[model samples]
Target: MAFTLLSRSPRLVICALLCIFLFSEVGVPRRASALGINYGQVGNNLPSPPHVVQLLTSLRIGKVRIYDVNPQVLSAFAGTGIELIVTVPDDLVPGMAASASQALQWVTAGVRPYFPATRVTGIAVGNEVFTGDDEQLKASLVPAMRNLHAALAQLGMDTYVRVSTANSLAVLATSYPPSQGVFTQDAAPYMAQLLRFLADTSTPFWINAYPYFAYKDDPTKVSLDYALSNPYHVGAVDPYTHLQYTSMLYAQVDAVTFAAARLGYGNVPVHVSETGWPSKGDANEAGATVENARQYNRNLLMRQVSGEGTPLRPKLRLEVYLFALFNEDMKPGPTSERNYGLYQPDMSMVYNVGLNQLSTTSAASLSLATSPATRTDVRKDFGSLCLVTSLAILLITQALLL
Candidate 1:
């Protein structure tokens, strides 16, 4: 009877086999790395929010960190699955810290309306407050965080949105040897209080760790290759911990980790809020070329996708957000300041940092396929295939039994 059915339904059997093969062979949408880019809108000629959304989606970028809560940006990203990290500007910190009602009102106006639609995961209270010269603003950091967090809790958004501030690398007094890292005496008291709050609330300590600035300040001592994570350089070894560091970025991160540990907040996570290389600079700026920028960002992206962690925190993957999405023409600083953007204000890439080709069916995908990191989509696809295959086999067996 089974033979008779097979003879009559040969096309059906062939079609079923073809379907299984096609499903198995199709390239699944592999999960990209946990990398996020800073969507800095300091320029006057940046693309509109909708265009920006399309650009990010095209690049398969799932995470972004904006300097402020722009309603247009928030509305544009609604239902897009991209996780957004919004900020409370530094100027508003003092006022928000002084009044809980103000904090509540600010959240209601800026954040509460477009939440689930926008996917606002984290709220950065201020950018580099500890490094700034304003003493009053420095004092307002913790209070601002507390008031904002309280406001979030009152609105039932605390569980969904985390509160933290981004601090500069200048907050550290000594960052050599990684293990001996310590916060500067002036910033220590405030850092300790901030760390306690971060620990209690389980918020990450955001640091703008730029090795480029360190290299630029003292080019004679710092190896360019080390700063760029070049494989040719024999990187430094932490004398105390005997840990090897191939890149200055990881060393800086470990330093912050050690600094936090010293303050009895060992478990608090440290995230790189901003880090990038400049594509162009003045004659005095060493290693700020397009080649260096490409190498630095590409290598950084590869490491991020590989889920590589610092030597100090080998098990936990490092979270990093690259600085400046566009070259801000109005930014007042050294030439390097405006050149750190990955793209121009026109949305064209400054250089091919391997990110623009990430979603393409080119050699980049082949490179990604061989990467050490686990692709979430591949795992999910295989699981789905296995279920489908099992069902198909069961149906075939039942047909044969009949």
Candidate 2:
């Protein structure tokens, strides 16, 4: 009788363990303040808007930024409670700036149709206009923004939808010590005008800061661990402010803050409009590996969930939007340019970075694909699975005894 009972206990224990593990995994609540993702549709093979909406909802990503106002995407996102930031293309800036009526028409046609239902929270005037050599477009960016704001105000949507433009980190002439950060001389006048508008309207200064570019350009000087925000990296300290920076992303953010302060708009909030690490790249691309991407994104997501702020603003949580939600095979530039996505064209993950609905096979595949060094680092940094497994085993053991 004791032998019979012991044999049945093993099967019962296995069943109980499976049940407990499933319950624990599914019962975990998602973070309330999750970070945002940039949904770029430059690729032809990307999923449809409905499928994309379902994918984002499954992942519990509540905020998204898109390059244009696609009516299909906007309509699909209606009633989802997912906040959206849409953009006006560069070509439209000149015309919009030339006439307030044109701006009003653009807003009415692109924004008013699906706003309250779709939760359209912001409108970007143009992307990275300051980094380009187009003097005319650069000159028109502020005026276009002002016109858009006025249009929104006329329609009673100004309080809900903010207007601003995203700038690349190349606009900064100096960003080393965080305290000595400043915009280039040529960009200063345009930046001051833009900053005044932002300050007056209580809008955020959007910056696309890519630490990968810095590391790729000078791997000998830039630390890969620092870029990945690994705990093992010994970070740098800004001499003037004495603020220690564990991650290049935070340092870059504070640099923008200081730059804004120099223009007498120190209190204006800064938002990361685009930032991400590619899962794969060409042979020449440094620190572009599956493991490094996992570490960079996972660490960044953990920080976002923790409501972390830059050294300059301790109380206000730094809002960030991860770049390129889907890998765009058609994106022009280096190999890394096409591979910054957390997901592939088929909606499969590039690696397990704590996203929802990931299968056990996907997780195991990720472990096998990464380098041994990254495997070790991942094991050290991410212990949530191990904790869950241990707890499930303990619960099963208790149930078997009962």
Using TM-score as the measure, the top candidate is 1
Candidate 2 lDDT: 0.78
Question: Could you give candidate 1's per-residue lDDT for residues 295-360 as a string of tens digits?
Answer: 988888887767677777655557888886788887888898888898898888888877766656
Q: Measured by TM-score, how close is model 2 to the native structure?
A: 0.80
> Scored by CA lDDT, what does every candidate get?
0.78, 0.78
| TM-score of every prediction relative to native | 0.81, 0.80
Report lDDT (Cα) of residue 205, candidate 1. 94
Which residue runs of candidate 2 sit more than 4 Å off their true CA positions? 1-32, 357-402
